[model samples]
Target: MSEAARQAWPTVRSIPVSAVTDAKPPGRLRPARLEQVAGSSGTGRDTTGGGTATGVGTAGAKPSAGSASSAGSASSGTHARANPAAELGFSGDPGQHGDAGDGMLHAQRAWDATLATNRLDNLGVNAERQRLVIKDVTAAVGLLVDGWPADVRACVQSVIDHTDVSVLALDLGNLDGAGDVLDDLAARYPDRVAVWRVAERPHWRGGTATWGESRAKLLRLDESDVHVLMETSIVLRGDGLTPLVAAVAEGAVAAGWRGVDPADGREAGPGRVPALTGDLMAVRRSAALSALPEDANYGRNADLELSLGLRGELVVPQGALPVERLGTHDVQADYRERESQRNYDGVLRMLSAS
Candidate 1:
């Protein structure tokens, strides 16, 4: 071949030869063009210049075509040898060869971003919906002068001092200036206190018979988160409202003290009795307004009846919650008799039905 023709032809280099099953013609070997060599199409298998007669194989060379299934198997084998992360478009760490740290960091960031988006979605407010604003609680104290204005004042003061819950005093013809004292306190703490005057004295005789009237009056005025049935004779000593509210949060229908008999002078322990004292019972507004019977007039047994009706429901006491007992003139005297009758009547009625 001429120099230009030689330059145009592909070059051939010596490669190791192995065994061949085919026979070759007995003649001197002739030079063949590189393109005519089988397995020379960049597959690296035709390292030797000789044809199939000379058995030669390159390192890491792909399998040459034999049968359809064998060719397919060879292609699949090459694919299986590929790096998994690389097949998924993930380039590993620049500093660490064959390490998937970069891919992990990317996946972690994606997960964090998804969580943040979910949190923001949960916090998003609806523009068309109205928000609820809790109204301040209204309170009414039924009092007759009876020279107990100081006691009433103390009760009112304790409520004001210990709780953000407001109080209102409803005076029922207290001739001994109880109304005036309550009025003065209302004036002093105008934001927290209010005074109302009833035309006649309320008929409360320390018995459960007057529950209907008292509950009616309370229901007429206060519709807050809770209604405090505070007796004017009882004075609170500490943060009574907090524990009461906390009890309510624990699924209590009502909560109070002196209502629950604490064992061994402790706040709470074994052998506790469940009862509701009108002294300072916090009744959940919904439960009180809904469950309490309208015709039930027994004042002393009202708490017990209400609690009984709410059986299977929660009723907690503010254990060891200090509260001073002032003079319980009409109501305190007949408490035992009224309570006994109320309980007996309730039990008998329940048994008859059962």
Candidate 2:
């Protein structure tokens, strides 16, 4: 922000990181915070406080269970209500507009009354037009669990956080208790997560479990129409997988977050592409079962090999998905380098024929 803009903005005291604690999955996060006055606690607890950190609110005071039940009842009757926004804390009344205490607007933007009375209604507004959520098309994310070094816990949690689909995680010899982590997540989200444990080690990590074999196993295990191939290194910012699955529903054999056209020697895109990257690719489980290279021991160009094998459209949707790559996994450099080159050679042959 510019100096002027910085000056205009109110100083944000503290920001909540994540409510979900790593140690405690799906636990109610504690909220007591802030120190103001000499030995004054914002949380109403008797504690000595020192510092200029002002009390934002008594967040420590949780709502009563009875109140929560009442709120739930009110929510259940939402469809019958004419003014549901009132229940959701939205108010057209100017007096109800939030302020910085004693009737001061937080920002000049608030003073304009644009947002205070602004109508941003979207409850069933575009329900019919949005093609991304076509009816009856089930989807699930398929990820390999080679070891704990791949951030399995965080990756599974991220998938659970961002998408509504079930996760079919294939655990190949839970290298370093990685399979245990999958078991924990499966227990935590029994309805949303499933794990297949194999005693064989991963071929890429110097194990017998080959990439093609495990990927094909995942394909066979998953019954969803759209099966996503996501590496643990990939993190999503939002429902990034939805659009890819939507593209599949729209009649594409495969749709990935990124694409490559080896024929043209460049990245390809929002339409038909020769191949795709496997970092975050979604495919039809039916097609993927037969197309995935069973002998490949690594991903690298294996994804592209699968892409080329598919007969229909391979799409890279327009605009960026809310996803971030956390680089490649902590695999052996020599193994990855050699395997990647080998896979590329195979892709080269496929490219020549096409």
Q: What's model 2's lDDT at 12?
A: 11
Clashing pairs in 1: 145-174, 206-331, 207-300, 208-297, 208-298, 208-299, 208-300, 209-297, 209-298, 209-299
Model 2 C-alpha lDDT versus the unseen true structure: 0.64
The residue-level lDDT of candidate 1 at 76 comes to: 58
Q: Candidate 2, residues 69-178: lDDT per residue as tens digits?
A: 24644556646766543543536575774333422232233323322222211232222322334456777899988776458887888889987888988777768888
Candidate 1: misplaced stretches above 4 Å? Answer: 1-147, 205-209, 260-274, 296-298, 317-319, 330-344, 347-354
Worst 10 residues of 1 by lDDT: 126-135
Deviation (Å) of 77 in candidate 2: 64
Candidate 1: how large is its RMSD? 40.4
Tens digit of lDDT per residue, candidate 1, span 225-295? 55677777787786555555444433445556644431222232111134555566665555565556555
What stretches of model 2 exceed 4 Å from their correct place? 1-132
Which residue pairs of candidate 2 clash? 39-49
* Per-model CA lDDT versus the true structure: 0.47, 0.64
